[model samples]
Target chain A: MKSLIVVMALSIATLVGLVCMRVQATQSGKNQESAVSQSTISSDSNSELAQGAPANPQTSSDSGRSLVLVASLTVFVLSVFVGFEIIAKVPPTLHTPLMSGSNAISGITVVGAIIAAGYKETGIGSFFGMVAIVLAMINVVGGFLVTHRMLLMFKKR
Target chain B: MNALVPLLYLVASVLFIVGLKVMSLPRTAVRGNLLGALGMLLAILTTIFDRGVTGYLFIAIGLIAGTVIGTLMAKNVAMTAMPQMVGMLNGLGGGASVLVAFSDLLNTSDHHVDTLIAVGLSGLIGAVTFWGSLVAYAKLEEWPQFKKPHSLPSQQLINAGLVGLNCLFIAILAFSHNSAIQIACYLGIAISGSFLGVFLVNPIGGADMPVVISLMNSYSGIAGAATGFVIDNNALIIAGALVGASGIILTQIMCKAMNRSLSNVLFGVMAGGGSAGNVDEIYANVRSTSPDDIAMILDGAQRVVFVPGYGMAVAQAQHAVRELSKVLEARGAVVEYAIHPVAGRMPGHMNVLLAEADVSYDKLKEMDEINPTLDSVDVAIVIGANDVVNPSARTDPKSPIAGMPIIDVDKCRTVIVIKRSLSPGFAGIPNPLFAMPNTLMYYADGQQAVLDIVKAVKAL
Candidate 1:
């Protein structure tokens, strides 16, 4: 229990740190708008040909990449905390539906699969991406529908 | 329109969280599921409209095919087969993550060290989750080859070796600048991770499937999160982390319910270690009865508690059990179900089966909730359940299931166990509860026995 408290406190600290970092990044990004306009222009010019380029540049500097990583990690850790708190309140009776519902949520990978499949280059990459999209769509559709079916059964007398 | 993408994603994320929060209660759970589906729909639509997604042919085909298949599966699956259904879905989710990571790796020409590491981790964990979930599905479906636990020589050593190989590949993939070397290392990591998954889950017995499935669910989530990192998507990371956390909590709950450590369950060493020599001694006073006799006892009972297990699921006796409970309740006998945490092939298995039979969720009492009131129960009908009701859990320290929490049905005035034979349960140990002076065993299929008792009770 003490350890749980410590972990909670640590996570809260991390959350604060992440929020501060995001604020700083946004402020800095606004200040550097003119300075980075050249790089932005170059990326926009490449975007037409590159087709499936990521939001950030592939050759992002070390600090830029690390910032993205840190932001992503922050979201991951905080979301986990939210998951634990909400899911722990679920009774044993709803365990199955909770599992199937959350299983459906993991199908969020479909978003990534979509980008991969719909990328302009239609070749081996698109082929595998299409397959991934199909698989993820199945997970999303089947998982949600099945969970709904099961939940519909937990009725009153 | 470009600014709306992140805003819409944020909405979807909030919807997902609200959906899960509202699902804590049965009355609101159905709506909660629908809300979650809405979030998924929103996220999918937003992604489709996002910049760089210029091609739509493959997306259209994939979505149509997936919807058709998914609808059929959701509509046609039997309640008894839910464990395998969930297992299959986990495997597919993991499989999708692996392909997403692969496609991301191929599409990007330049790679940052962090993105490369994330890609490697996603491939490894996703491949492991996919194969491990398939093995779990096969085991749960009771495939002939997987009916019994199988272990290779020095299984742990082999698993460790596979982990080492995967780590080495991930390191090389992260450091390597050559596209060919990176791709090769990625494939190598996936292959080794697949083997590690199979080997890790293969030796676990059927009784530990709940833990295995939950852990796999967690792995699938972590894999998705890794893919999120690879692609730099906040929605994917948040959703995946939520699932990862949910699975971990469920796995911990299951392990605690069985009074076994996670490592003990994973090692698959819990079986065949019971005190078999005392079986005859324990069964010396075992008493047998008929359905009519059980009905006679039930006729005078004021309160009854029904304990259902995996055997109830095996016989598909939930409806019959519900019928019996209705008959008992009509006669002024208070009827309630006592559900153990790890009752069936998965967590909440019995509740789902019973709920399908029109049994109200409110009537279902958890083990900790019902155990104290069991002594007041005039009749405890343990249908197709064994280890959960075994008194040895409380009495015998040397027993494999000792220290595990049980239903304490033995404390009731009369205990009626409906089973086919004097056979032991998954634990493979004789239950002294069957031999207690107040206990009576009725031999028949769970559904048949319940039907017979219902008929006899109606006649009485």
Candidate 2:
């Protein structure tokens, strides 16, 4: 009984903290806005943005690029962590519904990649862009197909 | 900054891919969203470094305004209204992405015809998804449209023509005497999208909106990601892709649960004579139970399964329901929760509220798992959910819900329904479960009624 009380108290505190974090983000945005001025802006406004942006110098620009490249690769690899977590915890019955719905959103990635490819100027860029489009297409087509299968659950016949 | 673009895009693409994959499952979809968000955050941070903070003050204000509205919408929106909220937000995402692409095109003076065409296409699509999704949202929320079963096939034809015409605008804008064509395309996008929104939602009944909402959410995410390409932003692309994929999967699942297709759920929408008033007229129902009778039902139960829905949420009966459950459990009866996927306004809505009332997560069982136990349970107490526990889904093939997955509360020995009135559910179908011989109807406000049940159980 005592433990239940403690848990209840903790849950309330967690809810409050989440709400506060949300409020704080809003407040911070407001504060930042009042700090800016319209008169000080220039034609090459991108320059101003770049100036104050992440001043921590990329330790050896070449190495920095390599580090970002490595980080990007690691990010993709971490998706496996996501994979393991979902399949293990999800109840078997909900698998059909959840998968079909999310698959539709996956279709958007293909559409995005297609537009990106269409805009590319170079042969290599276009080739990679085409690859992006194809991957996105696969996601879109596959998602729709899966969704169609799930709809069979509701069929009258 | 330029060198990082490729790597950043690669990471964004990966997040987009994985996020969609994870969204297919209810359990991990939330985690999938968080992971996709992290990838987008990385993309956003990278983009900001190279971005010229053009009119930084306005940008800041816009961001602040968007955040405030978005947060309020997220926190306060009811689960029942979740589908509508999803539709509105999706529309906003698509609209904003199109706006971003348009701004980019307008800022640059150089006439790269290919780039112009791409931006135009992106803008047109973004606008269409935005306005169209809004109408879809309105329909889900039951925005007071008087004409029932409204249909407009011509609107669809116009929409198709408008999209093609917008592409033509790009080609003309590339070598036109003035920028009128581009402006006209924007106008057409706004009009067509708005019209399409009405047409899409006009025929749709309230019942199938959860599925449509999920689908619209996917459209919104895809629009945002596609727009990201126009602006060459890695983060937006990743975030948009994640949201889009997950939305699709969720929509598919909802359709399956409803026994409908994405297309059917959207376009095969129907609004017929409301089943509630007509049923009440058809069968002169008699009140067979009082508060005392309800107390007796509670007194005799050895096991109970409580099913809650939007009506419970509307009643704000989480606290009272928890107390009632506790009282029943103390009476040496095993109590469990039957959580239907589409029970409340949104996914896990009842669970979240129940959790808020300090209900143990272990007590909640998904519908399929709980349905089997219903037959063995002495009593099933349905707080406010109607369609979820309806026997029609199981016994009658001609019923509106027919093959849609439902909790087998009809199998229970005794059933009690506490509701405001005999209002039909979002499915717009009458619940025969309410009229079953074994079931007792005690219509009142859910919160007060649950509290009464608690007191009755305590007296027992």
Q: Which candidate leads in TM-score? A: 1
Model 1 interface CAPRI class: acceptable
| Candidate 2 stretches greater than 4 Å from native | A1-157, B8-40, B51-55, B68-85, B109-117, B136-180, B271-287
Model 1 ranges with Cα > 4 A deviation: A1-60, B274-277
- Please report, as a residue range, the 10-residue window in candidate 2 chain A with the lowest summed lDDT: A33-42
Displacement of residue B10 (Cα, Å) in model 1 is 1.5
Candidate 1 per-residue C-alpha lDDT over B1-460 given as tens digits, one digit per residue, 9 for 90 to 100: 4335655776787778879988889999988888888998998998887765767998898888888888899899988899898999898899999998888777664566878899999999999999999999999989999978899999999998998888899898887766777778998988898888899899999899999989988988899999888876667887898899999999999999999999999985875654556778888898999878888999999999999998998898898998999999898989999999999777788889889999999899999999989889999989888988888889889889999999999999999999998899888888889999999989899988899999999999
Per-prediction TM-score: 0.92, 0.68
TM-score of chain B of 1: 0.98
How does each model score on lDDT?
0.83, 0.54
Candidate number with greatest DockQ: 1
Among residues 3 or more apart in sequence or in different chains, the pairs in candidate 1 whose N, CA or C atoms overlap within 3 Å are: none
